[model samples]
Target: MDLESFLLGAVYYYGLFIGLSNFEFDWNTGRVFTSKRSTLYAIGTDSCISVLYIYYWTGNANIVDAIFGKANLLHEYIVVIMTGLRITTGLFTLIHRWYQRCKMMDLTAKVVRMYMARPQVKRMSRWGILIKFISGSVTDGLQMAIILNTMGRVEPQFFLGLGLQYWISVILNMAMVQQYMIMLFVRTQFQLLNSELRQVMEETKEVQLNRRHQGVFMTRCCSLADQLEDIARIQDELQTIVNQLEKVFAIRAAMIYGGYYLSSVGTSYLAYSILKHGYENMNMTLSTVILVFCWCFFYYLDGLLNLYGMLHVQDDYREMMQILGERTLFVGLDVRLDEAFENLNLQLIRNPLEIKVVELYDVTRRSTLAMIGNLITHSIFLIQYDMEHF
Candidate 1:
């Protein structure tokens, strides 16, 4: 096989490796959302292999017509075989991704419902939720566009490999977005809870003056404070994970894309240098072989780099999951209210002034609720409007 043909095949194998790797990771993480992207990547790589085969056959035909009397029968057969393989692979991958997308949509809806049902979260946070959803959707759309463009242009044998690069990029980006949003929500919820707790502490001072409820109230306040501290620590760890992911992505981008382009340019220059030296004995076939070999080597290297990057992204996500799991465990533990509120003063009052507290609470709750409602409604409306316009 010619250099180009060999390179194309190598890229196809590289894509196969990526697909298998992603499948394993997804299965381990229970993240079926990645399966569709992985399938598309495999298909794209397969397409690249087919395109390269066609190019190699065409090149061989031209060479035969120029020198020999007939085209090579083997080359023609290889081209037909590659074309069939490409079509089949592409079709299967497409179907798989489509199915996966539907499943992800359903899962996202369920997650949204669960989030909405959380009583501790303020309604105002809905605005942030909506923003995150919109941003995530936009990011996914951009990623699909990138994949289509890359896959549509790659040579046959190498088609899926190039597409796999974009697939990894899209997945990593989405994961980063999700982690960031989760961190944001965690912080917001902590703040809201803290504020409410402080207000409760202040209001209960008068109630404690005469009420038997002083001990319970004080215990609850201390327990809330402990929960807040635990959440804050988890948030810190999440931020660390986010930072690590960003750094990993930057290094991977440099190594994969930068290295590929640099190597391609260097190899092309080297080929040109050989030609410029007037090496008449070098022949076109030998030069073509060298060029094809170099291209294939570079394609394989790129795939390896992408795989490493993906592993790093997954590691960061796993760390975040660990932190969240730990936080949940801590939250589940019983608080020692007797010990926490032991030093607190509790006063009981016989006839405390009403001070129209109920009216005040009603007005404040109504205004806050209305504000939250407006914010959520406006964000949803804006998202809808943008979707229609786009």
Candidate 2:
């Protein structure tokens, strides 16, 4: 384990803390309403999940002996392994938060820079936080209700059997909230940079007079260059933070998303079996269906929002470059701003600031939209095969 991971182990994670301490946290008066409650929930859920893990680990359990005994041996094994992964991810996220807090440079200054500069950014951050909290609560509550309702029909301890699934979803939900916050942070910083760049360029243009003001123009150019460098440094720092986050979340994302895709396929294959078995229990099958769709919707919406925010940030950067290029047209003053602009542009272009999952694919609008369709196609094939076989 790295120093960070070791440090994380030594510290206790209250509610799987996604170390928001690095950001603008006001511990004095700012209260996290759900923190305490969620910690209790985490403790309870872990207790139940631990029992399942022990069962599987000690060979006291097998695929066919798992909950419901409905799925094939391979399917059951995959579910258990994935569940373990999900729990581990939730804990790691907390550990990561602590590590980032202790070892990394504080991001409160960077986050505050944006919040102070843009009212809209502040408004958006509030709305983003509100949305994540509400949606996360509603989805987890609904899923737990559905699972308990579905399985409670047959077994009273059904909820305990799926405790891992519930908390895993919660952890993933919280992680995505962190991702969204980072995206917002980057966008705001870029927006600030873009605005400042335009202002500087315009000022330079206004100061540009016929030949005699060469020194004044040079001074203005130099000032613009300094500002650009400062903003670029922040932008680079933001990118570094994002790359680090991607590395941290990559495996978790892969497991979560891969599990989503597999569930899509599983639902397709199992729908017929469920319908047949549940013909008399319409409520049960319907709840199961709703639960699956809920998960899909959650993953789809979260992915889209994150992708949109990132693309928006990049678009803002492109617009800044365009403005710089246009302003350079009539500039006969000095070459410093032009050179600085070129250098910054090159850096931006080289980085491109794209997000990815396990370096698998660029997180883009087209790619995200395609995945939904891919799920549909793959699900249909699986359903068709099951229909033929059974």
Candidate 3:
């Protein structure tokens, strides 16, 4: 609906990747637009119905069978849902409560936006945009190829019926990528702040001194202190957003981790069964591979995003403030930048960004390694169980 003017599809798909929607939120009005909802509903209904009808009419096996330990189809649908959920919940936490996350980040982004207006930053940003675009396109192309290629055996009319679902999936995938990319870019912008502040200090140190210079130096230090105060506010807001997201992530972690465990372990079981049972069908094997790929792709992507956006930023931020405080300007602030920086540093240390899945486990590199270890162990157990019992 009015796709050209509004980025309607992208925004709506972006919404769904968090909770579910293909609509525009008017920040001013606080309303989600309904222009395309009817169309989306029609298509979604058709896709779901087509899958069911195809199962009955064409005798296609239940997709869930393959999901548990079989392989009737690839990740074409599952990734669309899982990754959408990952991004959906993420964006929800950010955008909910009146754009809480966006508003908080926007303060720092405002500063970085000025810095980014510099020629070098603009050029790098343009290139970064291009590379990200190309990389995402390539990834989708591969995913589409696998899905359509594997779907070739399906009846033509039935296959064609689900085209809109697939189209939306690609759009949603792109949106999901966009969300994480923006999240990462925001962190990078903050990092740029670190460099920018340090440069200002360096420049101040380089200037030669006179009586007038002392006056100028004090004025600049006062200005720096003011900026640090704003940054202190930013740190506070960012911590609030992180705390809320941690709770959201905690709920999400359970679903994602359980999904990975089931899909990974089940796909492995099915693959072994295929080889052992000698179901020489290429479709089965191809689907299994795609399923496994989906599990790994979203699972690891989720980890990396959290690692960089949440974990790394926590440490780097605290350290940045510490170093900034050690600067001569902050050391001599009449109002005491030291206390502000110290409080910010202590807050960050006390509440390092963390993502806990259902209060069960925190997402970290160590946890990731352990998850893999456990998955492998469980897969082995599944194999042994099948061999002994079946």
Candidate 4:
């Protein structure tokens, strides 16, 4: 019911862990306050980890030596590209979150106020959060085991690279999950708005039906109009929330999607090369295969969930529009009702709700399918090249 009640579920801990946010929240006052100590810690930790990751990889010439005897150009390049993506994304998340910390705090305050205003809305589900946390932990553990088994004795550089890679990966993954969860929260708000509108519509129809037998017909109509206006205002606020969150996440969303594509292609190619070369150490080969497969599985699921969350918000918007259209038809010939219906329709039309990635392109079903198609096509090309070459 309150911000603190749900913050523990996912946002707060992940933010603290990944340096996404370092602000303290006052639940009673719905205030988000930041301290110099927390800010310095977030900045220092993120910067040090990033510098260490870069330093470790830059001088290390044996990156692929653990997996391949001779350097496979493609595999090495893929590692470089993937590492670059991870670092770029990790740094961007940290920097951008800091740059937008004030705006984010304001948005958090808005969300808290919205929730306070509507206690009927469902609180964040700790069960879902627990399941996700457990799943991620298990996946990370499996990845570490597989990598250690394949690479054998973890040299300092190898350990450093692997540890840093895991750090960046965790940061990006947590950011992705947080964005998805916030969008889900917004979708729920839209849903609640639609439900309230439906109730008002039903009540209006009942009042109309009893108009002949009742004396407070005009009074009831006026009350319904007030309810409609209140719902409109809520919808407007929800839209603002969506837009503000978009600013917070647009670039990161694009980077995350791009990271997924690169990961899938790189992993697919690695699997092909491993198969072709047929490493003499059977255990190493098997471990490498499992490691690649596990990474692919987690990335695939992460991308799917993000895409679904975006699409679901779009679906809710469409449903809200449909309900508004229905209400328009039943508004009769009253000038006030007509204006209200027209204004709501026009507002939706002019400023439609859209979840965008990269700040320019809207994430729709068609676009998402196309993205998947492109990923598959690229993976196939890379796999074919690996077969013919390495």
- Top TM-score model: 4
lDDT of 1 by residue, 1-390 (tens): 543234323432443453421221221223324466666675665456446544545553332223212323432333344333333433343334344545433443333343344434435444544544444445445545544543443445444444444454433333334333433444444445345434434433433453466576556556545654544443344344433333323323333333333334434433443444333332234444444454445443433333333333334333433333322222222244322222111110222111111233221234535644754564455335434542
> What alpha-carbon RMSD in Å does predicted model 1 have with respect to the real structure?
22.0
True lDDT of residue 118, candidate 3: 35
Per-candidate TM-score against the hidden true structure: 0.30, 0.71, 0.61, 0.88
Q: For every model in order, what is the number of clashing pairs?
A: 24, 0, 7, 0
Choose 1 or 2, whichever is better by lDDT: 2
Q: Number of the top candidate by lDDT?
A: 4
Indicate the residue-level lDDT of 287 in model 3: 59
**Alpha-carbon runs more than 4 Å astray in model 3:** 1-22, 25-139, 154-175, 200-214, 244-253, 267-311, 318-333, 346-351, 358-360
**lDDT of all predictions, in order shown?**
0.39, 0.60, 0.50, 0.72
Window of ten residues with lowest summed lDDT in model 2: 3-12
**Model 2 error, position 172 (Å):** 2.1
Higher-scoring candidate on lDDT, 2 or 3: 2
lDDT by residue (1-390, candidate 3, tens digit) is 332213323434545543333333443233433456643653464355335534544555433333223323332344344445543443333334233334423433443344334324333344444444445555556566655754664555445434433554454444344444444444555565577666655644543233256677667666656766666565555555455444533443464446556657665766676677544443445554665466446544543443455455555565676666655453334344445455656765676555565667775668778878998998788778768766
Off by over 4 Å in 2: 1-52, 55-121, 209-219, 267-296
Candidate achieving higher TM-score, 2 or 4:
4
Which residue pairs clash in candidate 3? 12-22, 12-23, 17-88, 18-88, 18-89, 66-70, 250-358
* Candidate 2 residue-wise lDDT, 1-390, digit = tens: 443223222222422442322222332233223355544554555455556655645653332243446544444444565566666666555445544543222444444454555445544355555555456556667767765765655544344446555655666665665666667667766777778878877776676654466676677778878887886786787777667666756766676666666665665555655565553332335556677667657655665576677778768767866876775466565677777777877777788677788998776668867987998898777656656654
Candidate 4 structure quality by residue, lDDT tens digits, 1-390: 444355444556666766666676764567778888777878888788868866876784575665454547787788788878877898888878877888888888888788678755545434434444555665666666665675474455577677676777777777877776567667778878788888877887787567773447767777777877888888899899989988888788788778888987887776666677654532245556666677678667656766776788789899988887776446443456556667888889999998787677778989878877988899898877876875
Per TM-score, what order, best first? 4, 2, 3, 1
